[model samples]
Target: MTPSLSRMIAQAAGRLTFPVKWFTYGRRFRYEQPQKGRGREFFQWDIDILGTDSFAADAEIISIAASFYKKLGLTPQEVKIKINDRKFLQEKLSAMGIDPDLTLPLIKVIDKRSKVTPDNFNTMLTDAGLGTEKVSSLLNILDDKDGYKNSEWLTGILNIIKQYGFDDYVEFDPGIVRGLDYYTRTVFEGWDVKGEFRSIWGGGRYDNLTQDVGASQTIPGVGFAMGDMVMEEVLKKCGKFPALTVNKTRVLVTVFSPELFDKSIELSNILRRENTLTELYPDPRTKLERQLKYAARKGIPYVAIIGPEEMEKGLVTLKNMSNGEQKMLQKEQVVKQLI
Candidate 1:
């Protein structure tokens, strides 16, 4: 999924209030090769907290994902949220005598460690300018299970997550240096516990993102994006997929005859203006029996029939398709009852 930073840059000019929480879900297109859980075009859900640099912002952004997983019947045993701090890893790299300029490129390499062979991973490090001994040291550091305890910021964020009762779903992973260079701290990914799929979601804090994008003001932000493709796969595998319905038309207005077509259209428009989902029979010449059968097949709950008699009285025959009940009421009264 495309990161939200690109979208937030346009909002920088507005100078929104601090501690802004934004959520959006939409279609995203990518140029990468498609594979399992990966597609060229997909839907993504992005949740972001911006304009605050507090460590609490990091915890809150993470908690949003944890809460969502729990709501979807995904337990801690089925998923884990891996977290790491770039600033913490940067210190380790600097301590190993690596040049400051190479840290970003090195992180890019580390991000791919899971997708490559161990030999290839070492080769990548040396190719990035690390000496043999330095590569050994870096690998040792990455393998350290307790490395996160050394960073106060990392520990603080983890503890905050603990307070939110999601400790089981989160843990520190030293190898999780996200591929993006703009992330200043707190990179995280949601993954299936079985490791059978790509990351379910990923994001981190980008404190300098707005400035990096050429905005006059600096807007600190932390967020994550979840792709629908992988999420749906996970739900089906876990047998938690919910039944969904496609038909949304709540009312169908039938044109009883060619002469009463205008009245049917007018009633349809009126119902729509009242914020109701309405479908008007397109063929004015269609018989009433065919129209009723169409609505029944489409599962429309209600039908409003406008005929010569009903039009003369300024009323509509509202039929409850579910129970085969009909009532004659004024148009206003019908609209109120339908709502």
Candidate 2:
């Protein structure tokens, strides 16, 4: 195997609804050096349901994945992802007289299909203790797994995932060994519809984790992860990443003095009602210009001032930070009038 570590990040969800086995990625390797969206050892957000068995988790995870990609500006049409269960592979292997227990080493070699030669692949399988018959069987299975022309397993898998309501988000593939010994049921990978080399994220069912870790419970779960690195790469390849500016908090509501505190409070309350995020100045003696600069520096959107002229007639002034537009409002109407 290429011996690389991969990470998948998912949102916090309670009680997963899909069966996902543990996926042991290739050798432990991390790039400490920095590059575009990557580091030698960057934190890769991982979301997995180790021990809950259900399809609800799969549905929720896939939906969230779709939502995240959409939020990142990828259309469903541009990205066609695929998912399947490891059980199907095991079943196929069993049919070919390959003991499921031999899955580990064989999987390691299969995962290395990209970086190795065909002759080397054969030698690796022979070293893994597969007889000639077993080798021939494996080769046939691998070759036919990618096509639906004559594989019964492919037919069954396609029908099954469709029933799970993931017909659109998943497909069957024999070549996707996933290289994880514990992946009991489903596995998945996200890819560009055009067959790009990089994928944004992918994962699937694992039902035996809790039991394997010495728990008596057969908690089956399914989930996937998207690393910020690969997702960024995929986005960059697609060429539509929007400029990500640091969104700030804290809107400045000028406090002319304690006299204007009540007015500020009223205006603040009104702003809250309209869902306009803001903050009233805490210091009592800060000057108007100082507060305005503070708001501008902090990137605050709106500022309201209750000066003596407006305060005398029960009025408040609202200022827009970007365009310098000032709006006058009645003191009593200030809170309700400025949205």
Candidate 3:
């Protein structure tokens, strides 16, 4: 992560965002099946805003996440971005008289809260050295209804999110302590409304991560990562995924015979020169029916056939694969129609 982040910073990106494939070994055997959203291999879309510590930066990150959901045609009712701050959590714990040394371990337990049963989660918390009273207090903090209401950092970011018209998609949830220790503040995760799937993505502010990676300068950054597997699943379930279509070769030039192959090639080139995506049938010996079938299979909408007679007439036969409509047109007209 540091290597990629460093490269983005070096490239002068004010905010870096991209999808990356990641691999991890689940050596601890936390769960049996690596199905649904959790797996050893996955693709994550990461968004990071570096070199700023302002609350506006945090708001911008959240807004970007909201924009992504909007682009996917997901409404606020379909998805929610839960946010919390590590600094706030630490302050709460310190006020509760919990040892700072035990905070990280407790956070790990909190991260697994949804994965384990309540009894098992409590046992894990106790095993991590929290007494019964402290456990109760911690649970209260985690479950507080107005946890972020009084938090200046959170409210500031929330106000900015409202300005960006994404407040409906976001909310303050104190339970959102990202599992990673590198995160210093503003942790968040995207969740399905029904809670039927694992988190779509999770990330937060990691102010000191760059310094930990041996960078001489400190780069305060906030970001999130969404795995492709979970996102794809959610989009399909919501019927938001668009119909897949062929993006290349909008027009296919069919070779009628060996003798007129050059005419087909020239037609394809001319169409290509006019900014049209054209594919030429490789073998002139292939039957015209076979070429048309290939174009249909590839979802190429238009096919241009330059046969012996059509070549002699300085015209090409254009077939619309969808409607089976055919017309004889001059080369310029064919190009115009295809483009």
Candidate 4:
């Protein structure tokens, strides 16, 4: 599941990921509750740039997710991109004397605030050994509905996104952690702003992840993961699905009679030679009305009928379904008629 999702994401972004890291990680597994898009065993998308740390890297990842949603037909209004920096979260946690490691799990818990009651969340904080002061401060930061109270880090990130021309779909959200232990910088999430699902796609910076395993130097990188289920739901709900169709095949050759089957095949070959899509009716037992009706219903624009008379004249009768028009046509003339 993970490899499939990882490959899909790579293709969407016109990139590829090597599988050597999976072997290095020992192919770990963890359980998650099964729901509409969750499962006990599931896909995880990971991406990084081994040497970049510019805010542009962060913005680029966010834009990458946004572009994916755009391709899926989700309107800009229906999608909202949210970002928060792990550095900023660490600083905020540190200011309250809460150990960032201890607080990291709490961040994952707090991420579920929408699913749990306020009383339950508070009890959770108490159980996690958070003092009343730290709890109060954290709750206040989370509940700051108005814009003025937001910290400068958030404002600066937002400003940079605007400079990058990606602010239209971006928002500063304090609650987006991406829940992993390795995120050390900017994190981004895409929300179906008005939908039932909580998040559509999310990713963040993990400068220390590669180094944690073996690499000596730190590698700063950013990327996100998108779930097909949530994205397809959002796209369908918003009517963004493009038409699923195939190349147009306009001409079908009808088998007028068993004796005339060879003539129909010849006419079809001529149409093909002229570069017009042509189908030779497989069975001569069907009625002319049924065969022609099949062509019309299947969106074939032209049907060629070569009976004994037309075969004698070295011509065919081209039936245009659009206006119920029919004309005797030479093999050279059928291509222009269909086109």
Candidate 5:
């Protein structure tokens, strides 16, 4: 099993809590190369707050995930956070007289429901040592729309999430029994609304993880991790990918000719001093047309050309590559105009 981050926190005198890294490897045969979301090796963004067992901690964690979606420009209509409590699921199972040992195996099967056919899923449950009668009851509970409607834990945490104004991005989901024995309460998964992609991310409260690993005491925690692959696909589908640009070059200083190369270099240095992102052409002998084309190709929005004619007047020709507009500006005015 992967070592518990919670245990590490307790040993370190509560030094680290939020934004931990959990590096893990998955089987290549199952997680094939170049797939939309699956891969052989990946890192998970595991955010957690230790030393508190309050449902408020769970609410705060969920709010952080909703805030992240907002940052990515994903509307509630485009994605949602599905929430459930493992304790609630265990309660329902106990009510149906399910053997405690079979709970983990049963959850693992339910976790694969969307991937397998209904018949195969039922067969897997039977193979995992569940009798036909218990399997029927379990399936009914899993299918019940109102299964979690009466859960006080779910109700309380959701009310807190509403106060954070993230209710639109979340809903009660009994089927989300995160496939892990460590998670004791408040499990969740972020899903794409269109259902065309896999889960954007998922996590839950693992109150026992610290003690399970080796700690003498438990630390309650909650967080989620999103993979870059699925997030990129979702952004592309929603047309929310930000416009790409060369980060260091908002303006390109083109070497108009060998004779005027020094002027271009000087102007670039001035722009840099003014806190502008500037790139200077390295080759003085490069053609003006070729240099301008290079600037445009690099997504540089503006270009400064210091040819002999402009140099004599101590002026520079500023061109807006996006609109193909050019104007003559005094050397002193270049900084103000470009800025």
Candidate 6:
């Protein structure tokens, strides 16, 4: 299993008050066979808010996750966040006369419903101590899209999520009984609409975890963790990966020769003062052609050459790498062209 930041958060909760919010990003390690989107080590981002049991907290966290996906250029058509409440499911199961002892097992079986065939799922439910009739009733409940109407908690949370303007990206799914047992209410998972990969992210409200971690008092919390690998796969499949430049340096200032290195530095500084990204060649001994090649490979769009001829006239030769056009311009003119 992947390491949890909740335990560490619990340790820190002792000194804090309610409604605490914290986020962490760091490398995570696991010992498991790697696959297309699964790895032994990856970066994960965790965001959690503790000390409130209100449905608003749950809705806020879910909205945060949805907003993150939207910011990454993922649309409701490309991905959706499935949500469910454990307590709501439990109520439905009890109303259906399912044994309290079988609740946990039934939820676990439900979690695997999509992974197994219909026959295998029915068999698994029966093996978990549900009779044929109970299994049939359970399946009907899971398939009911209006089941959330029966739970005031679900209704309130959904309404709050709508207020956050992410209702289109969120939906109720009874089958999303997140695999972790610590989840107490409002469980959620983000999945590609095509169902082409594992969940991009998952979390829910875990009110008792802080107490379990030896806290003197219960600190209700809701959070989610998104791994870099699965997210990358989704972004790739949806053609959402941004076209990022290889480097931030937008201009390369070539040193005409060892004697003109100072001129190159002055030009770089002038461009920088105008908020232009500039890189100066460190080795003046290098040939001008080699410097140009370096800038080309680094994706720098413009290059400034301060050769003896241009220096004599107090001007610069600005070369446009894209069209190979060159212009002789003063320092002020060079800054204007860049900015």
lDDT (10s digit) by residue, model 1, range 1-339:
324454564465477666778888989899999987789999999888887898899998898899999999999999999999999999999999999999999999999998999999999999999999999999999999799888889899999999999888998899998898889999999988998887888999988877776676777888988889999999888888888887988899999999889999899888889988999999999999999999999999999998888988888999999999999998888778887
Q: Name the TM-score of candidate 2.
A: 0.72
Cα lDDT tens digits, model 4, 209-326, are: 6555554544455666555555666667778867776747878899998999988888778778878777888999898999988997888888899888998898889888889889
lDDT-best of 1 and 4: 1
Per-model TM values vs. the true structure: 0.81, 0.72, 0.86, 0.69, 0.79, 0.89
Residue clash pairs of candidate 6:
none
lDDT values of the candidates?
A: 0.88, 0.64, 0.83, 0.70, 0.81, 0.88
Q: Which 10 residues in a row give candidate 6 its minimum summed lDDT?
A: 1-10
Worst 10 residues of 3 by lDDT: 19-28
Ranking by TM-score: 6, 3, 1, 5, 2, 4
Give one clash count per candidate, in the order shown: 0, 29, 0, 0, 0, 0
User: Could you tell me the TM-score of candidate 4?
Assistant: 0.69
Alpha-carbon error at 79 in model 4, in Å?
A: 2.4
lDDT of 3 by residue, 229-332 (tens): 78888888888977875467889999999998888888888888899988888999999999999999989899998887897889899999999999999999
By lDDT, the better pick of 3 and 4 is: 3
lDDT of 6 by residue, 25-64 (tens): 9898889999988899999898888888998999999999
How big is the positional error of residue 19 in model 4, measured in Å on the Cα after superposition?
18
Clashes of 6: 0
Give stretches of model 4 more than 4 Å off.
1-51, 68-73, 144-160, 163-165, 212-219, 239-293, 304-317, 329-339
**What is candidate 2's CA lDDT for residue 309?**
82
lDDT of 5 by residue, 1-339 (tens): 224566667687456544343333333223566666666665445566666788888898899889989998999999999988888998888888888888888888888887778999999989988889988988898878676668888888999999999999998877888887788888999988888887788888888788888888666667665666677778899899778643657888999888877888889889999998888989998898998889877788899988878988889999999999999998778888877
TM-score of 3: 0.86
For candidate 2, write residues 13-71 as lDDT tens digits: 24434433334322223747766656564434445544345555665565556556667
- Name the 10 consecutive residues with the lowest summed lDDT in model 4: 19-28
- List where candidate 5 sits over 4 angstroms from the true fold: 1-4, 14-34, 41-46, 238-248, 255-266, 273-275, 283-290, 299-301, 306-328
